[model samples]
Target chain A: MLALGVAFSYTAGWLAPSRLSAQRIVDALQQNAGWHPGYRRNHAKGVCVSGYFESNGAAAAYSVARVFAQGRTPVIGRLAIPGGNPAAPDDSSPVRSLALRFDLPGGEQWRTGMNNMPVFVVATPQAFYEQLLAARPDPATHKPDPARLAAFFAAHPETGPFLAWAKTTRPSASFATQSYYGLDAFYFIDAAGRKHPVRWRVAPETADHTDAPAGPPSKDDLTDDLDRRLAQGPLRWHLLVTLGAPEDPTNDATRVWPAERPTIDAGTLVIEHAQDQASGPCRDVNYDPTVLPHGIAISDDPLLAARASAYADSYRRRTGEEAHVPGSAPAADATKASQP
Target chain B: MNTHPAFHPLARVLHWTMAVLILAMLFIGVGMVSTVSSKHTWLLAIHKPLGIAILVLAIIRLGVRLRFRAPPLPADMPASMQWVAHASHWVLYALMFAMPLIGWAMLSAGGYPVTILHGWPLPPLVPAHGALFGWLRLAHGVLAYVFFLAILGHMGAALYHGLIRRDDVLPSMSFPRREPSPPQMSDAPATTQASAVGTALPEQPPEAQPAGDPASPGQGDAG
Candidate 1:
């Protein structure tokens, strides 16, 4: 038995730990985007904010979740750029992420990580892993191998729509001016036990109306823009829940429901303050997409489980490192004053 | 003078070393699953190799245990308490071996490379399959809780013997402490032959000889 144990310990690499495992995916991510210790494996650059979602009770028609019960639900959130590099230039990545955790009454919580894009790039975790590999830069050339990307694009035709969307859309001027979409579909359970498939987005009240002062883009442009805007006053976004038809694809995040789907203006999300993530209340939050409240249930989207796993892995890695936020002391007093 | 027989020196060394390693492994495992920060990588980096180390050490410890007899329980201790002690020790040995083996197999089933020291990736113990990975992961988690509870029980029992009972059970595994000699026996051997012989012969009654026996003081201090 001891010999068998020793033999098992010495043997190396009969099969690759599959790319599908969360660890493998995270490993690939760290490799593709040079590792940044003490930061998120993805969406490394972020600013924390505290706010509240003032529900108008309109969403109670679709689901029985307490957040829609005509009252204020406290929220802590992070605004981030999608990449592993914490100091990546603001304009380098087109995607922006909004991760929020709603602290409801009775100690229940709803956490979500949303993107500014209307649809996600891939339908399944496997494709996302392959995409990461294809996007990995060659050590010699310092660029993604064009042949590998071409082959990936050829094999995964579902990526075409996302690519087209990315090509047509420009990065928003400020984090506050973008509409964040919960790309994955979820089932809203009503009091009667009926499940309604729905997709949600928080549309900024000031989108398209605010003009960014034209200037050369700095590395911290987006973060600076947010700070300048928040200093003046609070910013608000309208929570819109789009009800899905029976034919809508709940499992695939890459597919979009028709624009004409009946939408409900559930609430207004008011961001009262912004703080540095290093010492912000949102620093330790995972923002796992599957962390739902009593009324919300995860759909069959494979990406949801994969995301929860990956986020968990990323959280574990960063928390183990020293709490080193690149640039400034935590504004503890300012953040404390903002709490309700 | 102390008259109780003590464990072999190597057995005591293995016990303390494993005690520290197992405690660290439990904390690392808990931290690894609960967070998504960059530290997750660092914790996992430590957790994988630490597990394998424990496995190797456990095997060696088992070998030592089989080669040498442990100090018998105090003669006055109840039969039920002795049975519990023996059963718990076996359970701990089983967990020490099972935890790492299951962790390795789980990683293998998940298709994750069981890399140690950030390099040397161990071969998969099983082929990659999602369902199997899921089950193995569940088992690893559940067993970890059981392992933790068992450890708490073991520590509690050790402390009970040391503090409340004030018996030789705890001292048997503890580092040997020096004892003052009795002035009356100027030329006698420092330790009683019966105490020394008791360790080498498992069938002997636990050293319950009267105090001031010439061999007792030396046997108590022998490493």
Candidate 2:
């Protein structure tokens, strides 16, 4: 009894809270790129959009999730550039994001925050955190210290391909024309409990894909462009899920599967309207990448958990500041106001 | 019940306040983990500061508990029951301190800020280390279940004393009444003399005796 008592006490003493580390990443982001109140720590500049995801039932065999059962699932989404400053010029960052929350049947929901990049910049959460630290602006120069960035690049060779891609790729003329990739791999659990590792991307259906003109960009270039497009008609994107082979890396998001892999056109995403984030339906949403329905599950990709944690922390900080800010409440008004 | 001595006023206040805070913390903790909705953000914001509040209260509560003597258990109560009561009380106190401290440390290891209010963040308790964070996260999850079980057991025991046993144990820590004190009979001597002669004498039932009289030093530390 005494031995058991001691063991019990020791075990009890070890209990701590989970996901406590997310705040540090947010803090690092704030340190790197100044804090913006009532805005996401990253991807602070964005436009909110409401739409519907019409599933074609092709993905039903891969997952038992009801969202894939050939139906229209209402979606609220946000499109944004990768930056901490909400007022940052759209041309400043090469990476763009498309985050969606699908309101499924039976009140179930699936949320995913995807980016335009084909793969993530880092392999692990630690590396990502370190990258944030390395990219922190020097106090004297107001720019990332070249020495620190060089040191980081030398240490992580895997970042070379992403850096090369970012350097060469031109920004898309509009958010509606860019393909958004879910860099992290996930498991689609079938009805038989079989797990199929897959990566997904939303390909734009618009035929007028073009690069932005070479000139100084407006601060609201992306949002304004999206607004103009929405004024004409609803924008559409096809959801494509790529099946991975057994040898494909599931844990490292930096690695990509073979281009020859089979791809499934799971559904079509129709974004009907766009509005300013402050008064938009998607303003209050947290598109955590891990918020999967019953048929979908997160894989061993470390970035997924890191993204979920950081998104949660970012969500908490912004919402806490929401009450102090005006014109940032009640999505209903914004929905009606943005309707054409 | 009127004869039973009430718990120290400060202890009672702390007990009740901590009770409410703890219950709220448990619910908030559960909600924060289960959902990734927009509501999760505010839940977490409330959780961080609330945890720190519980930590601060637990320290003060522990100090208050140690400084004042608790009322003695009824002499007729079984020895096993007395031991269980004392042991469980200590366990509750242990958990009250452990949960918040571990949470703070886990956050520190994870390199996260331990913000209490909106803008004020506490200093980290440990240096950032990923391995330490993983271990601490597991420990925190396991302990949460244990803490929940302990809370249920404590509530069950409290109800048993209040309803089933109908003993003075429950009332001892309850809100005090405004009744005048009994005569200055030096109730300490009477208690010592009765226990010395043995509780088996059957002349008076244990409930009939003055429960609040200055208890013997050893028995006064029942919890």
Best by lDDT: 1
- Per-candidate TM vs. native? 0.61, 0.62
lDDT (10s digit) by residue, model 1, range A187-284: 99888989999999999987576444377678888888899989999999999999999999999998899989999999999999999987787776
The residue-by-residue lDDT of candidate 2 on A35-58, one tens digit each, is 566788898889899999999999
lDDT of 2 by residue, B1-223 (tens): 3354556778777777887788667666665554433335566668778888998998886666556656665554565765565566666766788888888987776545565742235777887554465456556656776776666666666667556654445656774333324542333343344344344434533432222112211232211
| Candidate 1 CAPRI assessment class | incorrect
lDDT of 1 by residue, B89-198 (tens): 76677788999999998777644456663224677799754446545666677788787777677767777766676555566678543442353132123134323444
Query: Top model by TM-score, which number?
Result: 2
Instruction: Name the lDDT value of residue A194 in candidate 1.
Output: 91
- Where in model 2 is the C-alpha error above 4 Å? A1-20, A324-340, B1-223
**Worst 10-residue lDDT window, candidate 2 chain B:** B209-218
Q: Which residue pairs overlap in candidate 2's backbone?
A: A16-B140, A24-B112, B5-B212
